[model samples]
Target chain A: MREIFKQEIEQLGLDLVSMAEHMSSAIDKATTALEKADLTLAEQVIDADESIDEIEQRIDEQAVSLLARQQPVATDLRVVVTALRLSATLERMGDLARHVADVARGRYPEVAAAQGRSYDILLDMARQASKVGTQVVELLRTNDLALAASIESDDEVLDRLHEQSFQVVLDEDEDLTRQQIVDVVLLGRYLERFGDHGVSVARRISFLVTGDLTNAVAMVAETSPRNSETS
Target chain B: MREIFKQEIEQLGLDLVSMAEHMSSAIDKATTALEKADLTLAEQVIDADESIDEIEQRIDEQAVSLLARQQPVATDLRVVVTALRLSATLERMGDLARHVADVARGRYPEVAAAQGRSYDILLDMARQASKVGTQVVELLRTNDLALAASIESDDEVLDRLHEQSFQVVLDEDEDLTRQQIVDVVLLGRYLERFGDHGVSVARRISFLVTGDLTNAVAMVAETSPRNSETS
Candidate 1:
């Protein structure tokens, strides 16, 4: 029975990695759609959100079932709990990406040309975030604390880029309408938050690996730059 | 042994409620400080964050210890797990409030007078959020799903107020600069998100009682208005 339960938990971990990969891809495609103002790609991402939601629900059910049946303890219990938490964060990230796509779809025609440069910066941030997401899953799969810590460090770069994009949008000409600037700033804020969620997942991974939550926050603070150079 | 474990778990629950109360009060004070431009109050909130963090860490340790020693199953397991999740969310909410206060202190003298009306709107929103927070603790104490669902409904008012405040800051020429307006908008966002965290806690309570998560999302969707609101 213990061997069977261990096998089930291992499979659940694989399922979680698969779901995270799907989310990572969705984020990348959504970012691309936003950059190019491609309505078709945006629609694809919006449509894909349901699948992400479904996967999240499935993961939650699986975790609950595992808890009920296997009665997992110690590190096994932590792994299942962490997977559940990570799934929620991943779902939220997908929702944020969907939000960005919706915003892009709404403002496409009006600011397409003006948003070209800004979109590039946003895409860079999204790519960095996607990479971090991948690393988070990898860390979970391999139980790699150092790799998770490194992924956490990557969040600082995303934060810097996010802040820089905010300054770029805000420092633009005063003559520009509020809506135009608001859109750009909102986009930057969304990406910054997406990065935060990625950091959150990495933190969860760290907790699972070491059974210590405080270390993740401490490491993140130490790695984050003192200068707030993004502005 | 079972009785002792149950007693310990109950104690952990009470501690969680206490921590949530402290967090809710800290956020309230922080919001008021932001509105009043009270540096001392803002500093107080910042100082209080350490206590919140400490409580959160304690709750986590207690929950993990309970899981390892008692090996709680079914509802008992759910309660302990929920407590862990709740503390994590509460800690983040406290951090968000502190961030708002930091922004408030950052604005300081320039926003002291002009920010009054905006602060009024924010204060009202914070009050609503506090009510929801209180309701969440009550629901947890009673394990009452009905009360949790009702608290979920109240989140709508907070959402609308947040939207109205954001629009006012953006559309009206309130003697404040663009950065000031952005600061005000971000402050509202934080309060609105505080309400979100409240709803989340309530949802977790509902889940603990009924073992269902679908209804919680439905409640949030029902409360949300037709138009998309920025956070």
Candidate 2:
């Protein structure tokens, strides 16, 4: 019975890693679609989010089943519960990637970003978001604490880029239209939230590794930076 | 043993209702703060969120404890797991309310919503969101399937208000400043998501009362409408 439980737990981790990989791909493709105004790639990303959602549902069922069959206690129980929460976070990350694609699709013929600096800033934000997405996959696959710690700094980079995107709109000299300003605000927000959810995944993994209840509690308590106007 | 499990489950339901009450109050205060540009009230809502987070943590710990101590299976198991998920949703609702308050506080001394028609639309969104929040509390307390069903229509009202807000910004005649436009977009998104979370809670409750796995699975599958541009 113990051996079976161990195997089930390992399988749960692998399933989560697979979900993270799909999420990473969605982020990369969404970014490229945004950069090039590629309608086909954008449509593909939009279509693919359904599969990510389905994966999450499957993981959730498996986790619940494990809890029912094994009735894991203490550390083992925490692992199962954390898996459930982590899958939800990954699912939300997929949704954020899809939102990015929506912005790309919404401005199909016209790129969402303004020309020159604003465009460069958006591309930079997308790159940072994609980088964070990759790191999330690596952290999930290997359980590397250092990699998990690095996710926070990567998220900080994304936050800075998001702020700069806003600055580009707020700058009096930029001369962006209202539509461009709205797109920039919404896009920056979506990408920044993607990075934030990546940090959330890392924090949860670290708690699982360290068995720190404080970390688990703090992870959920931290507000997304953009949501807090003071940030 | 069965009686003890029953009582614990009842306690979990009551705890959720308490959390929903806090959430409902936060929504009411957040809307009032936005309408009146009341900085102190906004600050109150923001600070109160920490307590809401604490309540969620407590509820989670209790639910986990119930699972571990009782080793409940089948329907009993689903009850505890659903409690855990519902608390998370309620916690997020608190965060959304906090975000709304942040917007109000950030624009302190000046209203987040522009005057005239734009102002009315934002207030309407807030009121609808507050109504949904109240209905969530009622559903948690009474397990009323009809009330659960009503939340969807309330969310629709919020969606319409959100779109009207966008139209207010896009209308050439409105002449909203860039900052005002950004505020409107962010606020509308926040309120819409609040309504979405309320609908999620309602669906989960309905699933619990009806013992319908389809409702459980389908609830999370529904994407927030505004996230899809086609909506």
Who wins the lDDT comparison?
2
Q: Chain B vs. true chain B: TM-score for each candidate?
A: 0.86, 0.95
TM-score result, candidate 1 = 0.87
Tens digits of lDDT, candidate 2, B1-231: 889989988988888999999999999999999999999999999999988888888899999999889988888898899999999999889988999999899888998866667778988999998888888888888888999888866677888787788777777698677778778777777888898898888888888888888876777677466343322
Clashing pairs in 2: none
The Cα local distance difference test for each model comes to 0.70, 0.84
Q: What is the lDDT of residue B102 in candidate 2?
A: 92
**Candidate 2 Cα RMSD (Å):** 1.7
lDDT of 2 at A228: 30
For model 2 the local lDDT of residue A64 reads 90
How would you encode candidate 1's per-residue C-alpha lDDT over A56-133 as one tens digit per residue? 777877887888777777788788877877787887777777767777677665433145455567678767866776
Candidate 1 segments whose C-alpha is farther than 4 A from its true place: A112-120, A140-146, A170-175, A210-214, A217-231, B112-120, B142-146, B170-176, B211-227
> What residue runs in model 2 are displaced by over 4 Å at the alpha carbon?
A226-231, B226-231
Score chain A of model 1 by TM-score against the reference chain A: 0.85
Minimum summed lDDT over a 10-residue window in model 2 chain A is located at: A222-231
Tell me the TM-score that candidate 2 gets on chain A alone. Answer: 0.95
Query: How much of the true A–B contact set does each candidate keep?
Result: 0.13, 0.45
